[model samples]
Target: METLANLESFIRSAEHGSFSEAARWLSLTPAAVSRNVAMLERNLGVRLFHRSTRKLTLTEAGESFRLAISDSLSGIQAAIAGIAGDGGEPAGVLKLSLAPTFGVAHILPLLPGFLERYPRIKPEWHFENRQVDLIAEGYDVAIGGGFDLSPTVVARTLAPAHVIAVASPGYMADKTPPREPADLQAFRGIVMRSLQSGRVRHWTMRDVTGREAPVRLQESFVVNDPSAMRGAALLGMGVAMLATADVLADLENGALVRLAPRWYSDAGAISMYFPSRTLLPAKTRAFIDWVVNAFEAEKLAERFAGSLDLRSSRSG
Candidate 1:
């Protein structure tokens, strides 16, 4: 019989395509993971991976074995966890992937209360910009916008990711406010480049009446991150199009004001994602429930909406 440790090492190594990455995920040294995988291959009497200088690729036998045992491994772990007596309490590490800016500014605040309630659930959350393979990377949950909905995962919509133009109070002092999307071309625009495509994003602003107009502005500053663009706008360097959720505090405190209140870019839904499981772990279940409830309690959807006029006249 294959030891669970060896099986786990094999599974993680195959998924990550590298012993180092698998070691990181499993909290084991690379040499330890390699040793376990070697032992597994020895027991099975078949070579599991095609070893190369760069990355590990699963051999035919390895692929077949992985497919046969992946689901069973998950089942065994779940059974063991449930049978272990913390009195059904959610204990152990709960790994999560989160967006850097939004997650830090918003979701992080909820941790103190959550930890107070579920003291045994140790959160290991990574704040990043790129989409992660939740199962492969061993993340318990993810929070972000515009993630591809893979069949293995489930999503819960938290809020609408709506982008709106904003400018610092000082920057607007000498300039006439943009009444419509077209008028934005006259001002210095701080824009974001797409990290995935390596292209400058085009601004297509839509009003409340559903009229779409592309705004071409003189680029004064360009960045790849949303938080940086917001900072530039805050410094009175230029106007920027940013997610409403990101600029809510600035707009509320008069640090920044909306350019065209009715105009917004429909980015997508900000959602929380996790692997689909027949029985979710208590830690994961608790987080989902708490976050969903928190969003509702704070009226995040309404606040994140682009319908509010905090500055100049409405365009339409």
Candidate 2:
């Protein structure tokens, strides 16, 4: 019969990719972990890992087994913790991957209240522009758009990832704003290069009547980060197609003006992602519930949709 010790050893080794690293996590010696995994292999009658002196790699069979048992192991650990009184306080270091601008602007504000409510929980968060592997990286949660989903992950939509062209108010002051998507070809453009792909992304924008057009602008600068692009646009450098959520403050404050209020690109939904459908830790569950409720109460999706012209509303 296979014990949880053997299964845990196999799963931890698969996650860390080494017996030594797995030993560090399991608080056991490397030899002990290796022996446990070997025991598991003998019990299952199949080799799980390709072991070498330098490193360890999961075989195809090992990967399959890891995926199958990873969530179950988490559930078991969580169950044990719950029984051990960890469930009541929701205490732990909750690690999260968040987008640089949006997470700071929107989600970061919610943390104070969350911390107040759950005083035992500690947060360790990183703000970046790339997709992180949730399971392999040991992230409790990741908040972003356009992440590749795995079978062990779950996502909840926060908002529509709407993007539109914007420029500094001073830049648009002396120039005729683009009345149609085709007219943007005449303007100097600040564009974004994909950090993951290292390619400049093109925009396919649609008008109020659902007329879609691919407008290639004259590129003045290309940046990898959205905040940098927003900064450039605010400096009257060039027009930029940016996510509405990212530049909501600028647009509302008249630091930037919309090139075409009706035109936007529906990139995808901004979502909160986390590992596993079952046995989420108390800290993870609390954060998810809190953020979802906040988004709903604030109607963030509608406010950040980029269709409303604040200047027009103020004038009226």
Best by TM-score: 2
Each model's total of backbone clashes: 0, 0
Q: List runs of model 2 lying over 4 Å from the truth.
A: 1-43, 46-87, 307-316
lDDT of each: 0.88, 0.86
For each candidate, give its TM-score against the true structure. Answer: 0.73, 0.75
Candidate 2's clash total is 0
Off by over 4 Å in 1: 1-85, 308-316
Pairs with steric clashes in candidate 2: none
As a TM-score, model 2 comes out at: 0.75
